[model samples]
Target: MSPTQNIVLITGANQGIGYAVAEQLLKHENYFILLGSRNAENGIKAAAKLDPSGKSVEPITIDVTDDASIQQAADQIASKYGHIDVLINNAGNNNEFTHYWKQQESKEEIKLDLAALRQIYREAYDVNLFGAAITTEAFIPLLKKANAKPARIVFVSSHTGSIGLRTDPSSEFYERMSRPSFPAYRSSKTAMNMLTLHYAAMFKEQGWKVNASCPNLTKSAFTRFSDLGRSPAESAVNIVRLANLPENGETGQYLDENGIVAW
Candidate 1:
């Protein structure tokens, strides 16, 4: 890789938004991507599919839910590349969608399985919130060593995390927003948004731009190929732009395809 080339690591990149973003970034000559996946085989296949010659893309095995896995990946990246220009915390879990919807669909006598709810919430935070936190903490030192000017960190957050939209009476989601609409998934992203700001403030003096991005509703495996959402490539547009932000670009903000999203 050239000195001017940027080394970007994206978690959960084997498919969906992560893969789409990798594809988009690879179109630019200076971007080298590390496709992070929990499965080594899947990662290798995804990387090879992106770049058969293996020039710009490399697959990495990383499970966001596993602290040891995240740490090992960071160490490997540090050993191989010395530093990372960008880290996209894209790995996430929406495992509670069914439970949330099921609970919502229940009539007057809803059986609340507290234990089950707790399990799903724990799973959601494990991958969606805590995993990203752990991974970012593990890689902070390497990120600071980036050769690229104004190192960046992008949190792949969601609009579902917006309390304003959820609470606004006129909002389309308002009717179903009262409760149990994937609260675990939504709250984790909310926490992630706050996390983004904290990292942004902490690293501002260090020339690191950190921001949260909402890809909107993207139809991929994550959504069970829901027809209501846009394609993975379409949802990837804003994320690609965020990843390419300049030194003077906006930070500590939440963005979508068009512009800034309301907090």
Candidate 2:
């Protein structure tokens, strides 16, 4: 590996937006991309598809929700690269949507099942909130060893997490976004935004850039692979741009495809 090459690790990179970002990053001559997937087989497949030459891109098994898996991945990266120039926390769960939709059926008047709701919330938070937090924490020491002037950490957030947009009646996302009804997934993302802020603040003095970004309803597995929204490749444009930002670039802001998104 070149000493000047940028080492970037992206979680949940086996498919969808994470995969798209990995593809886009290959255009850069200086990046050595680590394609992280929960399953080792899937990670190998993705890495092979992305780089058949078996150079520049490599697969890393990382299940954010599992502490041992996350630590093992971190250890491997640290041993090989010493530090990571970029960390993209892209793994998330939205299983609550399926559960909620199913409950809506076979009932005259919809009722909330507190027990089921709590379970849903816990599952969503496990991957979206706690997983991302723990993954970032485990990689912090490796990030601090970066050869790059300022290491970067990006949380893949959503507009549904924006309190300002969800509360404003005139906002385009107020009614269109499904967050208001899906408390589990929505609240977990909101918590992710907070985590982004706290990390950005904690690493600001070191010139690290940490921020959150909303892909704006991209068509992916998360959206049932529907064709209603932008393509994963299109959604990755801004994320790739943010990932390549200079050491002096902005941090701790919620951004979309256009620009700053309301928090």
lDDT of each: 0.88, 0.88
The model with the greatest TM-score is 2
Looking at candidate 1, what is the lDDT of residue 156?
96
lDDT of 2 by residue, 1-263 (tens): 57777899999999999999999988954888999999999999999999998778999999998999999999998888789999999998988767655666657655658887788888899999999999999999998988887889999999988888887888777787634477778889999999999999999999898989899888888877767878999888878877887977999989987889888
Worst 10 residues of 2 by lDDT: 103-112
Name model 1 segments beyond 4 Å from true: 100-112, 170-180
Q: lDDT per residue, candidate 1, 1-263, as tens digits? A: 66678999999999999999999999954898999999999999999999998989999999999988998999999898899999999998988766545666787655658897798889999998999899999989998899888899999999889887677878665665555567789999999999999999999998788999998788988877878999989888888888888999989999888788777
Ten-residue region with minimum lDDT total, candidate 1: 172-181
C-alpha TM-scores of all predictions: 0.93, 0.94
What C-alpha lDDT does candidate 1 achieve relative to the native structure? Answer: 0.88
| Model 2 residue 64 distance off true place after TM-score fit, in angstroms | 0.6
